[model samples]
Target: MSGAVWSYSENESVSNEVASAAADVAKGASAEPVVLEIGAVRAGVRAPGAKLLLKGPATSDVPPEVAAEAIAKASKQLQPAAILIGATRYGREIASRLAVKLTVGCLSEVSKLSADGNALAGERNAFAGKVVAKVSCALPAIATVKVGYYAAVESAGTAVTESDVGQVNPLVKVVSREKKAAGAVDLRSAKVIVSAGRGVKKKEDLPMLEELAREMHGALGCSRPLSSDLGWLPEEHHIGLTGVTVKPDLYLALGISGQLQHTAGMKDSKVVAAVNTDKDAPIFQASDYGIVGDLYQIVPAIRKALASRR
Candidate 1:
């Protein structure tokens, strides 16, 4: 039997990146015109003529429980063939809770989805994206895909009537809300990102990275080993297969060797520049611009040149 793939929508993700991936999967399904369902929480775009429904508003941080209840409710109404969610923290939580409640198989961090005969196929990262492992499951399958794994594709379809999920009062009420101070810079959304690796030698050397980022109007990022191993930078600033997948307009890698795992994360960036002492480093292959020199001299020169211009 064929099934539908559903994605959660959030207000910030109106781009519909996640929803588009779901539609792309639906197009390939054996089922006729895959059904697209959006939860009350808006993340991405709602496809035209797609079945839009309210799974009840999320109780802020209570998505796990809220999503479980919503999925159970949606199951009765849509009876989707399969459920697809993003691999985001909240999305994963929702998928996990729903999977346990429904007692069905669930795939996480899938980069590709397809059909192989009667079974569903999924491609996900393993050993830090070193290998792409393929998996399959029977019908009524559920999955959560990673961001940047699949690009959103346009499809020929129109919007359908809203399902009007009918409000179900939340059993759990949010007792308190704490807002953490925003970081010095929001690197995730920054157009340019200057990331460093272990080659920086010491945390005191980070000022140079920050200086370059300032001149370029970008934020700072670091490799996994540098941040996790040395604690030089916060975990939030790490970017790589083991860290964050970033698609900035411009990415400058200072002292980072382009490991397959690290390269996979930022491969989507529009422009990549690398500054490493070793000209044969793997990062140079992915970089649009390369500077083979000591970061100490190169970074200061670049900083001075920019300061002179400013």
Candidate 2:
């Protein structure tokens, strides 16, 4: 309860975000915020706190298992009150492993976090994101901080302390790596997003939505069904609780039903609009504007309206 708050992430950007969250928690606890960097010390160098560089053979291109081992070893030595990890795929694995190694509780995908005396309280979505639950764990806890909940922070020049953790042989060896197919746009950074859903009907109908997105100078996104079930779009385009989280300025859900799983990802959007044939669809509950009509019919009308103004 009296030690520093620790944070780590494989991605530099996410690491920075976790650092910010750590700093916030540490402030309330009156403890230092420490950043742990494996493989390389790049993220810790820019983080706004003390940096612990765990250097070793296990540090090079550190796999999740190796990174978790290194972190667990470090945690045993430092005995931090709490550890904040970015909730990326690998980060989740690392958090779980660390929790087991340390024999502490772990919270996954927490959007809001704070330090409360000897415990840490976190808020996370539950029941497919239809409900928000407040959860708490005693000190020496591990929690995966949800992405986009906190922005990265930078501090004036801070020194990093390097410690050699030595070599670690991983159980899982990566023989090859292949990049996922890249999308035409990065939906996370887009100001406007036109998302499709199961209502899209077919892959051939995607062009219509794509044209709408292009006309609005936005990117095309989709629900999990479109990407995971139908394969009409790549997984990169999917936005949901299990997929990418986005906070666009304008989120236009076209033919999307607005399931809790899908809305959890884009609920942070500044403005939301939905065009669906079902007037009673769940998507309307989450949207700021609703058009109860067929997207096939509504899309052309919107295009015509925009054309006339031009």
Candidate 3:
């Protein structure tokens, strides 16, 4: 319980955020916070405390299975009180495997984290973001911190230590890697988001929403249906529990039905405005401002109103 806290993420930026969260936990518990980096440590990484670089054959572009093995080995020696992994696709796998190896509980997708006595406590969305559950586990537990929840800390002067974790033969092998198609917008950093949903009718109607987004100085986004089901937009434009999670200053849900899966991604938005024809739509319940009307009628009026203001 008195040991240092460890944080790791496959993504450099996300690792920095985990480091910030770990620092906060360490402060409350009066313990050290250490950032664990696999392979070569990046020069840009800034941890609030110390950095531990794990080097080995298994650490080189290591798959989750191999990386988890190396981390478990290091953790056994370090005896960290808690390990925080970024809640990314691969991160979840690492956390699960580590928890099994350590025989400790794993908390997934935790947004708010804190030190609870000698144990770790966190709050995560449950029931599709409809409820926030407070979870706690014994010391030596593992938890995946939700991406974008904690800001990356700046600690350019932190100490660094390197250790060779040794080679691991992975069960799966990566044959090749290819970059995904880049989108014009990065939804994660967008301050304002105008998201379309199933009600958009057809692919041809997207340009209207795109124009609205441009007028509002925001990026175009869509619910999973518009992206995965209808293929109206690229997968990167999708926002939901299974897709990208976002926390923008303003989220405008146009013709969205507000399924729990969709709301799960944007519930953390500072302000939410929704337009729907159904008065009892679920999106209205989650919105700070709601207009019950057809988007076909409302959108044009909104654009005209903004034009007059200009």
Candidate 4:
């Protein structure tokens, strides 16, 4: 309540999202929201109110361990009331280390955050999303905000200050950096996604499902089995609890059993539609529109419907 609430993320896009989360929490506690930038300030990064640049380590990139050290050293002087980090792998490590260094509480994968003068409160899905758990920590705490929950802030604040936190060494040395495949997809930003499930019989049939997605101008996604077990698609395309969370305009689930793990990730979609041969499939319960039919027969019909309109 006495100090500013900070937001940070190693990823550029996720940083803006955390800014929005921090702003909401700051407003609840009557505090200012500040976005923290390490190494160098990024033009794409935004803050709901103010921004802080911590100079040290590499100007381009630094390991999470080194980043945690820099933030901990700087925080000793500035002393924020709360620190919100995006729930990215790098941010998770940084937040955990920062909390330990500061000897404060750390909340993981929480959203719908609030500040109640003395504490920070938020909600998190637990038990594979079968239950929503309410969790909180006292002020001067650290939290990792869930992705695909908050919209990214549109404007950047002009009030910014820079501090030299001093250079720090990394525990793990970088060997080499390789670019991802040319057409890698980020399902987080996709407006429309068609996800496959165990109902898909063979890997050879994947292109047919992919074609269906392309016909609807949507990206192809899958459940854990298709990606993890079958290796039909990369893990990036997997939509589930242990995979990526998506909040698309439309999420079409094909042959996916409405398992809680799978539904948890896509539950935030604006509209959900599912096609399964079994009328009692759990996926139908989570869908806005449910079709009790075979996807093999249904997919061609949907494609034909689209072609007729074109």
Candidate 5:
């Protein structure tokens, strides 16, 4: 019962969790689990009792064709009972292509997998985080496991084994990569966020929200309509269930009517405060603090108070 795990990084910790999970699945099964690392420059992984293999210093991100070829080579040699991959964007694509090449069934985003008698049982969420279901598959299977699902465990294992390097293909060459410029604050990781909606109207009114956010030492964010419809803010700053999910320490929604799609993404915030003219707005239900008044008059007054304090 041989198991295999792959990584795109030379650093073993990148796929260490997946390797450990593979080892756990292969425990007491009379087979040695192998941790295979595939890097542009070099590839190697570590576990207490499992086998570790490092290939070369190839590159950082693995190209789809190269990943497919590497998995194919390892499959031919190991005949692994199962292969476990992290369910990242790249991981999912690689696992799917490898499964097709290896002629095996591929499970995706599995939260749990255990060998039960003659079958492998998998538990995962479905229907957009609404339902949980279990699935079963036979041996020689492949699965893309969720990152935070299972804990990585370590135990005793054999000494390291060095395998000959596999074929290398340098088809697509990366020219360069650059990071995007950020504003004074980035809302994705902001501890506090103050957002506005269509009720604020006109692009000119955004300065009020910006002032409030600046006074609070936070970033200003908005709903899709405010960003996309009016072009008052960049689309990147939009926050809703369809957009980025934030767990800010405080989230202030001003002039925005609460929609479930928007709230679902922000409901996990530590503290939520809302300012809307309508007392019956859905935002009130989700807010830890609420102020009912016209945003035009109240927002400026709030800004003035904040300015006075500074």
Candidate 6:
């Protein structure tokens, strides 16, 4: 029962997040928490416990296929208690492959993780975030952790250690890596976010909301339809169960109807304030403050209020 608890993520930000989760689980299980670096030590990827450098993949571009092989090989020798991977697109694939390669149980997109006796217990959202189910698996299991639930731990860690996984042949090769769309932004860590939805009349009007976001020193986001259906914004701006999940200090929604799919992503936000023309819009139920008015009129008035303060 007293073995190492490992955390791994190709993403720099999510690496720290996963490490925080692993540190807590390791504490409950009375095991050491280790952050595993795929190819080289990333300066940005800091965690709570020891750092392990797996020196096998030529570069950090180790595909999920190769990452699984390396981690599986290392786990066999280290005999870890559990492996927690960040629940990003790449991390999900790596966790799945590692679980299968090592013949271990795997949990996906679980939050509030803890060590329960000889099992790993976590909460998973179901029914489109309407219901949360408690899930667990025996020791030596693999789990993909939900993001934004835990704050990143940047405390000092033990001295780094190195292990060579030897050579790994990837099932797929990464010939090129291009940046996301032009307007893409990493909304995970944004403290304040003003999101849009179907209520906006035209794509040209988005700048009005964008200006408001800038005045508030917050980022702009959107529900799925604004990006996926209407193409008013890039996919990165989309917020929903299928899109990016965010937990901001304040989420100011304008013209958003507040469907479950959209609210699911930002449910953890500290304060939710929504403005919708429909007084009965579902967003009001989820919001801490709801204004039944037109965003077009309300936004200008709010700006005037802000200006008067100055």
The lDDT of each candidate is 0.71, 0.87, 0.88, 0.89, 0.69, 0.90
How far is 286's C-alpha from truth in model 6 (Å)?
0.7
**lDDT, residue 259, candidate 2:** 83
Which candidate would rank higher by TM-score, 4 or 5?
4
In the range 271-293, model 2's lDDT, one tens digit per residue, is: 99999999999999999999999
Q: For model 3, name the residue pairs that clash.
A: none
| Residues forming the 10-long window of minimal summed lDDT in candidate 5 | 2-11
Q: Alpha carbon lDDT of residue 136, candidate 3? A: 88
Off by over 4 Å in 1: 1-3, 9-15, 28-46, 55-62, 115-117, 150-180, 184-191, 201-204, 225-232, 257-264, 267-272, 277-292, 304-310
Tell me the tens digit of each residue's lDDT in model 1 across 1-310. 4756665533234225566656665665655333334353233343433654554453323345565566667776777777777777667777787788788888888766765565557787777656778888776777777776555544444454445444556667768765433564566578999999977999998987887898899999988888788988887788887677888999999999998888878877999999999999999998999999888898999888988997
Candidate 4, residues 203-252: lDDT per residue as tens digits?
A: 99999988988888889999999989988888889998989999899999
Cα displacement (angstroms), candidate 6, residue 221, comes to: 0.3
What's the distance in Å from true for residue 28, model 1? 4.3
Better of 4 and 6 by lDDT: 6
Candidate 5 residue-wise lDDT, 68-176, digit = tens = 5676676777677777777665677778877888888888777566665545567875553445789877777888876544545545444656554466675766577
Candidate 6 — which residues are off by over 4 angstroms? none
Give model 4's TM-score versus the native structure: 0.95
Best by TM-score: 6
Winner on TM-score (4 vs 6) = 6
TM match of model 1 to true structure = 0.75
Residue-level lDDT for 193 in candidate 6:
96
Residue range 1-310, candidate 3, lDDT tens digits: 4888999988888889999889888885778889988887776677677888888853346689987998998888878898999999999999999999989888888867888887788898889888889998878789999999999877687777987788888889999987667654788989989999987888998899999998999999999999999888988899999998988999999999999999998988999999998999999989999999988888899999999999
User: Could you estimate the TM-score for every candidate?
Assistant: 0.75, 0.93, 0.95, 0.95, 0.61, 0.96
Candidate 3 lDDT trough over 10 residues, lowest sum = 54-63
Candidate 5: C-alpha RMSD to true structure equals 5.8
